[model samples]
Structure formats: structure tokens, C-alpha cells
Target: MTLKELLSPVKALKTLSFATESLILTWKEIASLFGLNQDIYTNPLHKPLAKPVTAILIGAGHRGNIYADYAFIRPDEVKMVGIADPNAVRNGRFARKHDLPAENRFYNWEDVFKREKFADAVIIATPDNLHFEPCIKALEMGYDVLLEKPAAPTEEQCRIILETAKRTGRIVSVCHVLRYSPYFRQLKQILEAKTIGEIISVQHLEPIEYVHMTHSYVRGNWRNSKTTSPIILAKSCHDTDILRWLINEPAQHVQCFGGLSWFKAANAPEGSTERCIDGCAVEGECPFSALQIYYRDKKRLYVFDLPDDTRKWNKIILRNLKKTNYGKCVYRMDNDQPDHLTVNMQFDKNITASFSMEAFTSYEGRCTRIMGTKGDIVGNMETYTVTDFKTGRETSWSLKTDYHGGGDHRLMQDWVQAVGHQNAQILSSTIDVSVESHLMAFAAEKSRLNKTIEPVILGV
Candidate 1:
């Protein structure tokens, strides 16, 4: 039976009655009835690797370690052959987890690259500024790369990485994990099925939780654009990518406006100290108080991983609280990234999109609204409601998993499979495909800085 015919009966019901009945059709059932639940798009036929696809990891930091841990989960699919990082503790932890010998663990990428290439691929999860060189070098060494996002901190560097990938005929996949997410994948399927008819516009918001902003951007590694990249490129390039992917068009121009408004010295409470560890009168009331976020919450201890011994952990955390940036009062920090940002984009085919990222939100997740000629979609990362304009009937789907909406692990699996088969085509966020989003982010930043509409210059 045709999908349209199958849905005809449901559509014929009154809107009020259909809403209740539609709840009976699970997302899977709706997809299946519409012939959209099959895995035909995801299941690419390729020759499996003769042996597990081995990889060398650069930067054993948070992101790097997360990707490395995937090997521990599915060792038969991919193997961690080498690791390089400056931090002894982080480097040792990953190396030990992967059972790497001393010979395979180096203190820096320079030292690791001095040896003859031994791994099939290199996973470059280094910082924003460090991405380009290692990626180009890895490709030159005849290794495919799974690079973390922003590609690089600049458009020129992004171009170089893409050019080098082409020159060396190597695969370079960017970590646009959202593309591999089930929620987003299903959304794409529904859109392609014309349930949304012709999409006219989209509005997307990324709520950067208040505490998260204080942790990552206010007092953390990505605090300054001069050292890293703009907030838009560092944080919200994934959103730009998602918007473009949903619209299925290249962005022609972008305009943006934002600045560091809340997390400045001017916004500090009366008698507030530079560090939260100090006896500040308002520490009890401050939402961005480092003490409450890092010390009070044990789950948040991942960022400050101390020894498991209670006494040692407490002592170390207290000592570090007085010394590290993590304990700094968010308002007194030297952070330059915007606490809020808004962007508008015009894409090919007259499709328009607007995006907002705010740091003062109660929750962390993306909320999106897509308006089409025949229907509309509205949802957060967890669930979405699709309503057909003509029938006024709605269908809803809820996603159970919340780890980047199940994108994180799925992206790792897809990358492993692609590398194992020497087939980059299996990846949804290949460097060539993802670099356009990077360019769009660059243009957005340019627009914000110059107060003018900036044209997107795509390299691929």
C-alpha cells in the first residue's frame, strides 16, 4: 500500500479526535506506515576491514578522551593504537584504558608524528587553534582523520584542511554529531517524505544553560576569540550545520548581532570577590557560583577529576578552587564571548533561517520550528510535533536517549565503519560537507563585528 493511502484514514478524522488517535501511533509505527522507518539510507554495503581499523589519538582532553572511549566499547570495530597529549594524567588515563604500551604513548603530537605512520586513521581532537596543522599532516601521512569541530579557528585554515584532504585523497570527517542523531535523522526522513511539504522558513534556538556557559566559555578554554575562535564558531557551528542540513541548501548571506553583556565586571554583585572560593557575601545566591557548580555537584566533578579518595579529592578541589579559573566569579572573569547571540540567514531557493544562542536559559538543548507550505514542525531535542496545515492534524514523536539526542555514539559508530571500510561516503558530516557550516559561522561573526550583512564564501 502507498504511504499516502495508509495515512489517508488517519487524516480524515477531525483534528481534535485525530490528536488523541495519533498518540497511539508511535514514531516507529508512523515512520513504518509512511515507508520511512527502513534503514536503507544508513546501511551502506562495504567490505569490512581485514583487521580492526586502528587509530592514533591526539589530545587526550575531554573531547579526545570521549572519542577514545568508543574503542573500549567496541574494540572489534576500532583499536586505539597510539596517544599523544601534554597532560600526563589525561594521557596516562586514555593510554591505560586502551592498553597501549609505553612506546605508543607520547607527550606531544610532534613526538608521535616523528615515528613512521602505523595507524589507519588519526583522530584529531585537539583545541581550535591546533586542528589545521595536525589534520593536514595526518592526511599527508596517508591517514584518514576524524577531526573535532570548528575544523580550525579561521576560514583560511578550514580551506587548507579541505584542500589538503582533497590533495591527499584522505577522508576527513568533522564531529557534527547532531547529523548522526536519531531525532534529527527521523526529522530529515519526515521532511523528505513531504509531510512538511515545501519548507519556507526555520527558527532555531540553542539554550546554553547558565551554568554551562559559566563553565565552558566564561572561565574555561574557549573564553577568548583571540586565543580560540568566536562563540558562534566555537559553540554554535553545529546549529548552523543543522539549519543548513534541514533546509538542504547553501546559505547565501548572514547577519548577526551579539556581545558579552552579562558576564562582565559591571554585572558583579556588591562586595563580590574575584574568586568564588573567597568569602563572598552573595556566593550563596549567585547561580554561576563556581563552588555550587563544581564542588557541590559530584556529577560535575568530571571536569575536575581528582583522586577518588574522599579526603584527597576534597583537599585537592579546595586547594584548586583557590587557584584555578574554575573558581573565578563569572562576572569578574576576562571572558569575551557573547552571553547571547542572534543570527539571520538567507539560503539558496529563498529558504530563510534564524538562529539564537543564549546563556541565560534554565536548560540545555536545541528548540526548533520549521514552517513549510503544507505543514510545520516544532520541538526541542527530545520530542517534536508535526502538524499538517490542511488537515490540522498533528503527530508527535519523543526520543528516549539524551546523549546529544543519541548522536554521540552513533557518530562514533559511523566513523568507525567508514574508516574500517575506507569509505568516507558513509559519513554524514564529512569535512567537505561540514566546512560550509564553518564558513557560514565565519560570515555570521563577520556580520556581527562589522554590523553588515556578510556573504558566505564556501570552499566546497
Candidate 2:
């Protein structure tokens, strides 16, 4: 058996006995003598912080809450000292959870900055359109920033954020959480080790599960590209960043094709009403019925702010459904994001990648295939397999998945450590590198709209 097979759990267990265990341990020692060990390739999340990193949270919404949660589990590594969110309910909820003092809580982001810089870093998880201002202000005030993805809604804004971070000499680690995922980290190691030889091409897919598409892109905050941001930047920029990272080259050319297909008024069922709760005849049969999705199935209700009373949840949800966009019929909403899109990209070293974002899939996860000179790798985000061409040997690993493949918490850990030591090297998605991915995404959207291949121009 090969070294990996010998070390694999199932095979190692089979050889476990008083004598065999000792023999296998000796073999493992001998194998380590050749400079091969599983421990060497770890992307460790736990690290000693030089000092605790205190941060101010801007926007206590979903993404904001997710990143701040890291503080609760590891208070020594990071602490939330201040919070600014427009919504009182969300702000109060976050403040109570983090135990923020009354003086530290504010009703607006602008108020957080009116005072002198109070924290080592700022976590800006505001809405897409609101990111640029707070990020710029926070960096100017000498606080390192953990800005949410897309950076901003425009190419110029993304570039400006990068430039501001550079000019101010404050660290800006964009929230490209996928880079911290164990599965992708292993893939990066395989390529860096030349286990798959030189890279050639890659195929990546982001299957935005159907329910998620309707909830977010069709009926929710990101329904209009003009208001929030294009779905490419809002959703699939993560994929673009992953492709750019895997290829390890500056993107040269991009061509894209897709459009808003099935979620418009033209495609609504014959008897459907503008709202699901309006006694629409087809509400019972329609899968996109808000009543079914929110009231009955209770899937995707995390976006809603319900009451504290568990017994009153149904009443509050139904009431909000009537008042908010959440109850709107999917087919009649003012959404412009494409249901399906494909992008072809060329990088500096003859490396190429094709990425597809599909909103029709029943399941969600990134599926990827990377081709190289020696062999290829294939994986869904949870598991991956590498095959060797010469020996016909295959090695596989199955990872225990969590939020964003356990990237959310892992990124927070690394960011806190990086901020504590004032070292950018600890992060994988620093602003300079992340801006390139956003530029590529902008180029893809231009290509799709103009029906011409677009050259990716870096910087402001």
C-alpha cells in the first residue's frame, strides 16, 4: 500500500493490535524520516494571539451577526467593544448577546466614527451599497477592517477601498471566507506541492439552491441589481475569487453569457396574485408561495425579525409577511439577477477557468474540477479526491462541513490573530488580492451586457 493508504483511518485500524500497532507505529516513524507527515499541511484555526483584538461592529444584520459570533466562542482572541446598526431590534439583540455597554451602542454607523478610534479593528458587515463609506471612514481612522465581500457595489468603489487601505497603511481583510475552508486549503496545498503538476484549466460551479434564489435574489434584499449589486458580485464573486486564487494568476480576459430567465411577471402561473397571502387561487400548489416557504415550511425565515415570544412567532411572521417584501409573489417582484450565468476567464500563464452559477439546482455547494499536467482533482465542497496518472492511485478526504464549509469561524479566528499581531500574512484574502476578483467579476458583467470579451483592468 502507498503511504497515504497505510495512514488512512480504515486501513490503520485494521492493523491495530498489540504487535501490529507497534509495527505500524514504527512504519509511520520510518515514513516520517522521509519528510512526509499529515500534520504539515494543516490550515490551523487555533493560534496564540499576541494580544486581544477589539472591534466595532457596523450593521448587526445576518453577515454581521455571523462574524461577531466568533467573539462569543473565543473572547480572549477578539472582543466586540462597540456596535452601530440602524435597526433597534437588531442592534439591541446584538448588543445583549455581546454584552455591550449602553455608551458603546449607537443608532447609526456615522455615530461610531464621530468619536476617536476606539478599537483595533472594525467589522463592516453593512448592506452591499453601504459598505464603501464605512470601510473608507474606518480605514482613514486607523482601524484595520474586516470588510464584508464584494467590498462595494461598483468597480471604482472596490478599487477605492483597496487604495484607501493601502494609503492609510491599515489592514483590510475582505470576507472571502471560502479561502479559509479546509477543503479549498487542501486543494491549494496539493497544487503548491505540485502533486497535480502545473495547473492548466479549472471548472467551478456555484449551485445557488432554488429556494435560496427565490428568497434572496428574487424577492429579498438583492432582488434588484441596480439597488444592491449585480448577482455576480453579490453572490458569485466568491466563485470568481476562488478561481483567481486556484489559478494563481492575474485574470486577462473574460466572456460571459446569461440573463434573468424564469422569475419575472411573464412567467407567473395563470392564477397567481401579486402576493402569496392575498388569497391567490394557486397558493396551495405554487412552490414559491411565501405562505408555504415562511409560514408552513419555515425555511429562510432567518431573514425576518420576529418577536421574542415563541408562541407569537407565527402571528408576527404572518403580519410581517403582509407588510414586507418577503410575502411577495416570486414571479412579480422587480428582480433582475440572472437565474443562470456562465463565465470564461483566461489568466496570465495560459491557465483558463470556466465558472457557472446556477440558481435552479435543488442542492447547494461548490463543485469543482481542476486539471493539471500530471493529474486532475474533483470535489464537492465537503469532499475531494486526487488521482495520480502514473501509479493510478487515488487519495480521498471527507471533511465535516459547517457554515460555509467551516470558513466563517475559521476566517474570524485567522483575522483576529492577524489583527492581534498586526500581520497581514496570516490572512489569505487581503484587500489587494480580493480586489482582483471583484475586477474580474465586473469585467464578466460588462462582457455579458455588451456581448463582447472584456479585458480585466486592475486598479482604480
List residue ranges in candidate 2 displaced over 4 A.
1-47, 307-309, 400-405
Error of 2 at 386 (Å): 1.4
Clashes of each: 0, 0
Candidate number of the best TM-score:
1
Compared with the true structure, all predictions reach lDDT values of: 0.84, 0.84
Q: Report how far off residue 197 is in candidate 2 (Å).
A: 1.6
Candidate 1: tens digits of C-alpha lDDT, residues 1-460: 4667546753433333464744534555567545675552356544456778899999888788888778767778889999999888888888788889999999988887789998999999888888888888899989899999989999888998889888888889999987777678878888888878998999999999988888889998889888999999999999999998889889999999998888898989998998987899899998888888877874356666686577777777777789889889988877899999999999999999999999999998899999999999998978888887776667777776322344666688788888888778888877777899999999999999999999998774
lDDT of 2 by residue, 160-197 (tens): 89888889888888899888776787677677777778
**Stretches > 4 Å off in candidate 1:** 1-25, 401-405
Alpha-carbon lDDT of model 1? 0.84
Worst 10 residues of 2 by lDDT: 18-27
